[model samples]
Target: MDFGLPKERTSLKIPPALGEEVQEGRVALTPQGVRELVARGHRVYVERGAGERAGFPDAAYEEAGASLVSREEAFGRGEVVLKVARPTLHELALLRPGATLMGFLHLAVAETGLLEAMAEKGLSAIGYELMGEGPRRPILKAMSEIAGRMAPQIAGRLLEAPLGPGMLLSGLPGIPPADVVVLGAGTLGRAAARAFLGAGASVYLLDKELSALEEASREAPGAITALITQSRLERYVAFADVLVGAVAVPGERAPVLLSRELLARMRRGSVLLDFAIDQGGVAETSRPGIYQELGVTHFCLPNVPALVPRTASHALTATLLPFLLQVEDDPLKVPALRQGAYLLLGQKGGHLE
Candidate 1:
């Protein structure tokens, strides 16, 4: 993954620092990316199912000089394991002793069981989320940005006819721009703002925090408007052409910021993009679901991230590729994610003797 930093920063000795060192099809490492590694003389192993989603086949990894291995073989041979999600118990048990596992480990909310598991593993477990700033994981934030940007595209597809406030996104002369209300100013919110603005819509970004609101006001211009008031939130909600719910509360279920009364008051046919449906959603009516219907409209589609597999895959690759490089550099220093990383090197069975 591209960590948005220049390659060759001798300061940190991380693998992904090399620019374009890892290409998109690098489940086992593409030939191009692998050739670069081989030139440096590094033996690489990749687990099956790792590159499948990225349009990379098993042959590609083999062609790149990476030994095609099962999860067990890969973890056994690999001193460092880089993963998207925290490894399940099965995944974690496969690692060799002294192996370091790097990925997101969101243990802030007293996830002591996982913490205990890591300690028992006797591996130096580092969390990606903790390595960076507070509460936010950069990789997850990047993925959220992609998800938020896609919200409008999905909304547009769903609302092909009569999209809002009696005006079209590509309005004719005298027609106003579509109204888009983004309910959070975090990564997802800002991404949604940019996406909507690109679609020729007037964006109103709402957040309870002054800092977030201020950031939006300054970073996004023209079509983007930022506000810190809850009073007017309903007014905009009722009149919006699209309501994008990206608000989040981290480990806890996201509170319902938009009430049932307000939802009922919303303009008929206006779309609601509940991006946080997985986190209990930001709308009162939202449930943990892929699709939900309320009165005249549907809301709270979880797994919106899965809708664009190719895009999600690339986004993930861009974000985490550097971490893998970091692992390659030291074969240690497992950085846990800000939240929800489960992989660790040790399990109940015992470490490699």
Candidate 2:
């Protein structure tokens, strides 16, 4: 099908992977997206049933110009591997030497042993979360929007009967709706605020920047926006029915904003949901917990967007497809693809240039 690459060009052996540990949705590349690469003179392999749980059947990939293969073959054949989550230790061993791996590396939280292994094996790795800075992160923003929108829904579920306080997020006439507090005015915080507001809850959004706080306040009429200070945040915590920690620093660990004492002071039936847990979290106790503790329920899954794999996969493909095509022409020479390569491999080895 040749999408204009040179006749003598080297094809990119790309394979899309299925997540092994994440019980929910995790396939990032869709069949339609894979077909785009196939049409561009790149060979794409889809692991058998990789996209099934994400609503893509094997036949769909076959029809979309992808070669369906076993997981071992998918890993063995590809010089460049695409995935949504970080590859496990076992999966890491399957990679061909010097293979390029791209996904949400979450290096701050990644195991030292794993990083060392990749170094020793001369593997090139790129992190989706750090691909671009600020709003420039098209892929990260798309997934963050999904997570933000789901924040209110997750909080609401926690407040439902048997699960939490038995209170509704949206109250009846003459009753007050839940108070939803979101930390950070970034893509994630804004999305969370909008979702909670749409559900008829009063939203309070806080950010370190005055410009951001003002922007959020102006954009969301009737919702409160405030500068983030320890005192101000602590006071708000006492009044919040749902506290969502979505604050993050690109390529760095998230700052801890809530202390145990402040958390204990929160309303007994309140919900503490930390979306930044994957980045070391924004609270002292912000790890995933099944049972509520400290008089509050905590929801701290690192891959929240993976809960809706189909939607996330489509969003991912939209952002990643262009780059995949660029790589086919000349992976090492293309400026953007080169940037990605350096980010993964560093200057130590594995095609840093």
lDDT of each: 0.58, 0.75
- Highest-lDDT candidate: 2
- TM-score of each predicted structure versus truth: 0.68, 0.89
TM-score of 1: 0.68
Give one digit per residue, the lDDT tens place, for model 1 in 1-353.
11100011011121221222222222323334544554466676766655665566668767766666665676667665555344455555766655666544433422236656565766545444333345546666866777877876776654554332234664557877677888889988988888888787888888888888777776677545556466788678877877888887654456678778888877776778888775667777776432324432444654455445556655655655454554445533433331233333443211111
Off by over 4 Å in 1: 1-43, 71-80, 85-136, 161-168, 174-176, 224-228, 249-253, 296-306, 328-353
lDDT of 1 at 81: 59
Residue-level lDDT tens digits of model 2 in 132-160: 43338777889899999998778887887
Q: RMSD of candidate 2 to the true fold?
A: 6.8
Worst 10 residues of 1 by lDDT: 1-10
Collision pairs in model 2: 125-344
lDDT of 2 at 9: 11
